[model samples]
Target: MSERETWASRAGFILAAVGSAVGLGNIWQFPFKTAQFGGASFLIVYLVAALGIGLPAILAEFIIGRKANLNTIDAFEKLGHKNWRIVGALGLFTGFWILSYYSVVGGWVLRYLGGSVTGAYFGAPAEYFGQISAGMDALVLHAVFMALVVGIVAAGIEDGIEKATKLMVPSIVVILGALAVFAFTLPGASAGYAYFLSPDFDALAANFTDIVPFAVGQAFFSLSIGMGAMITYASYIDGDQSLFGDGITIVFLNSFVGVLAGLVVLPLLFAQGIDPNTSGAGAVFISVAGAFGSLPAGQLIGVVFFGVVLIAALSSAISLLEVVVSWVIDNYDVSRPQVAVTLGGIIFLLGVPSAIDTAWLGWFDTLAYKFFLPVGVLGILIFVAWVYGAPAIDELMKGSGLGDGVGITWLWLARTLVIVAVVVTLALGLQTLFLGANPAIIPPL
Candidate 1:
């Protein structure tokens, strides 16, 4: 077999990881979820869940990847726990399942970007979204988006995934930051800020059960924790970099983007008196499109905003594609380009149902996020804290500039709090799914 490829630098690895984390989940879904759940109350719980549960899960994946220096499934076998490969396989499957519908959403973002250029959606934002959100237009756009992702992954690690993300991640940050500043300048922006930044404890207390599951799910989704994206990316590391430091950096940057997205999206919505909570699946597209249409030079702003989303979507898509591509090339004697195209074609075909009907897309997304993600995360934590045992801690502390003490604390936390929290969240998610108790928390299509 050919030698394993490694990241060109520490920065490349971190940026690529961040690029995976900072996707449409953070920007597209977050604001709408916050609006629907409890505004800032949901945001507060999400932050707590992100740090408490999401961070340690990220470390667990990092340890697995850096130690094995192999694909996610092989990492388990390499570490002498062949049966535990099931955990990695679950993660790999989750990423694949997610990308099937995720590509459809990416296509919607691309359509909006073009519509912005021609002022197409400006006339009737909701109608425009209705027209293009699914069917043949969406299918074609999904093909285009998948093609871009395939080309990037086909280029291999250093040249394709890493190089593309370095540009995409930074562009996401810069453009979103500028948009956030502009969003704040709009009329009635203060209400959006208050809704986003000020938590309603009473509301949070009342909706504690309803809110926490979604918060935990959002944290996992936004941080790319449950999927093997982080694990695959970490496997490419060439040095004994601080996994904790890198994890922290990835979380911080990703959270920053999530918050910035809320700032830009909510303010834009409120400034135009659009109610985001009722906007359903097309919340971002419809509400933000209306907001832009009503604003001076709104078309230009729409172009730039959707452009950032397109880049973010591609960055995440490439990482998900790489999770599968990495596995194929590792096990078989196939070339990267061949695996990329073949897998990309298959994934595109898988997404066709979602492209043809958004209800199918919602079902795919809900299944992955509500069931697959938490299960994948729980499996990894159990493997790391129990199966891998002490070596997991040692892997974390390798170049982390920390001693054994920190590693032990993290391990115990993973064993107790993280695992328990995930279990509770998973139970709640399952209850919601089976009982249909609270359908609102089910992600919008």
Candidate 2:
């Protein structure tokens, strides 16, 4: 086999990693959850979870990938015990599972973007969403989105993934920033700002227990933890750049973009005097898009917003496809382009049911977000805490530049605190999924 590929530059790797994290979760889901769970309160808990649990978990994956200098499955096989390879395999599966439905949503974003330009859904957002969500149109759109993803991955890492992210990430930020400024200029925009920035202390106090799990789950999902994206991305690190700093940078960028997204969404909704208590699926389609129909230059604004979604969605989809492709190249003799086409084809086929059936799409989203993701996270935590043992600490200290004492601090937290929290989150997720009880607590996207 040829030599393993490495990132062309540290900035490219960071941008690609940040792009993976700042996806639909940041733009579509985070704002909804914040609107649902007392905005500032959810923000506070989410920040804690991101820095406390999410960052450590991300660093652990980085340690594993860089220390072993291998792809996901072999990274585990090479670094830890034999059976631990399943953790990596599970991550690969999680990436495949998520991208299946994720591409469907990407297709939806494209449809919405086109609709914005043509005023197709201008006066009838709900009907348009329902009509396009299924049938042959949805299938065709899904395939088109998957092809875009495959085309990027097939070009190889430096030329493809890194270059694409370098463009997309900056564009996403600039567009969202401009939209937020424009959104605030709308009448009654202060109400939205107040709703997002001001905390409901009493509501937060009452719902503290229920909110923690959602916050942690969102953090995990936003950072692309528990899945192989970080592990696979980290394996391409070319030099002794600090993983600790890069991990922190990635987390901060993800959280900032999520907050920036909220600034755009909440203001737009409040400007139309729409109640923010709608279901997540309807928040963007019914509330935001419906509001857009009534405003001046709404079509132009809608085009920009949905365009942002398209860029964000494609950025994330590339990472998901790369995860599976990286593993194939590591273990098999297949070329990158062939693997991209083959796996992308299967993933596109898998998404057909989701495109045809809304219920299937919902179920897949729940299954991956609630069950598979947390389980994958738990496996990594276990591997880092117990199996990897002393070598894990050694790996952490190298790039971190933190002494043994700080490494132990991280180790103990991961072994005890994070593990217990993940277990509880997993159990609550299962409970909510099986019983129809906890509808208020949203899972991470």
Candidate 3:
């Protein structure tokens, strides 16, 4: 058997991890979610859930991966009960399911990027989106996006993921910061700032029950936990690194980027006299595009904005693809390149319906978000708090400079607070899916 790969450097691992966390959700979804749920008040609760529940859950996954030093399924199987492997399997499938639809969206971003350069969508953004959103062009773009991801993964870990992320992550930050700076220069920018920063205590109190679930889900989704991506990334780290510090850094960077994106998007929308409330899945091609088209420099700004999104999407897509590819290579005798091609092809095929049919795209998205994500996260919490038991603490404490007390407290929280939060996420997800009320209030396209 071949020797397992390791990250080239701590910075490389951190960048890769951060890249995985910051995706399309951060750019459009997070800001929209915060605005919908009372802005600053929602932000507070989200921070709590992210630090308390999301961070610890990521630590748990890191522990399992680093301690066992194996692929997702093998890590759980080796460290916990035999059946615990099923958790990894579920996570792998969830990642796969998400990436299938996610890639289709990535393709949409790519198309918009092209249209921005050509000024094709500038005339009638809605009609332009309708034309390209479905049919053969969308599928070809999806294939192109998948090809980028597959090519990167096939190059081996350190040489591909690490190198690509080291470049992509920093670029995303600079571009987003530039956009935000430009956004602030717009007239009426203060209104966007007020909407995002001002707290509404009464609104928060009244909507706590309804808002908490979505907050929890956002935290989970933002961190790329509940799926095998974090576990797979952690598996590549060397023993000397601090998972706790790295985990915190990842969360902080991801959160900062999400908020920064809001600063860019919200102000741009407000300046154009558009209601951000109407922005959903098509926030870029619709809301932001509407604003850009009216600007003298719309074509240039469009390139920068969509380019940042494309990089962010690709970074996250690579991690999701890696989870499945790692599993295949771990269980089979095939080479990494071969597995990347096969699995990439399969994922592309799975996403075909999404590219061709808007309803099918929505359904795939709903299924993954509602069921796969929450359930898979819940399973990880159970495995860490129960099956792994004392060893989980040992894994978390390594190089963390922390004592057993902190570790024990984390375990207790995971077994209690985190579990409760995840349960709420799962329940609300189900209710929204079947009841059609969507109390969790997810964003639309």
What does candidate 2 score on TM? 0.95
Q: Per-residue lDDT tens digits of candidate 3, residues 1-445?
A: 4678899899999999999999877885687777667777777887887888889899988988888778888887777577889999998998898888889989999999999999988888888888877889989999999999999999999999999999999999999999999999999888888877787889889887657766777777778998799999999888657888999999999889988988998788788887776534554567778889988999999999999999999889999999998888877788999899999999999999889976677677667767888899899999899777888888888898988898899899899988888888788778767775553234345
lDDT of 3: 0.85
Local lDDT at 240 for model 3: 59
Q: Which stretches of candidate 1 lie over 4 Å from their true place?
A: 438-445
List model 1 lDDT by residue over 1-445, tens digit each.
Answer: 6678999999999999999999988888898888888789999999998889989999999999999999889999999999999999999998998898899999999999999999999989889999999999999999999999999999999999889999999999999999999998988989899999999999999988778878888898888877899899999998898999999999889899999999999888888898877635677788889999998899899999999999999988898999999998889998999999999999999999989988788777777767899999999999999888999988999888888999999999999988999999999888777777546344455
After superposition on all CA atoms, what RMSD does each candidate show versus the true structure? 1.8, 2.7, 2.4
The C-alpha local distance difference test score for the whole of candidate 2 amounts to 0.86
Global lDDT scores for all candidate models = 0.90, 0.86, 0.85
Q: Best candidate per TM-score, number? A: 1
Ranking by lDDT: 1, 2, 3
The 10-residue segment of model 3 with minimum total lDDT is: 436-445
1-445: candidate 2 lDDT, tens digit per residue: 5577888999999999999999987897788878777888888888888888888889888888888888778898787477899999999898898899889888888899999998888878889888998778889999999999999999999999999999999999999999999998999999999988888889889987557666777888788987799999999997778887888899999999999999999988999988876654436766778878988898998999999989998888999999999988987888999999999999999898888876677677767767888898899989988778778787777756777897888889999998888898888777767675545244323
What is residue 401's positional error in candidate 3, in angstroms? Answer: 1.6
* Stretches of model 2 off by over 4 angstroms after superposition: 205-210, 438-445
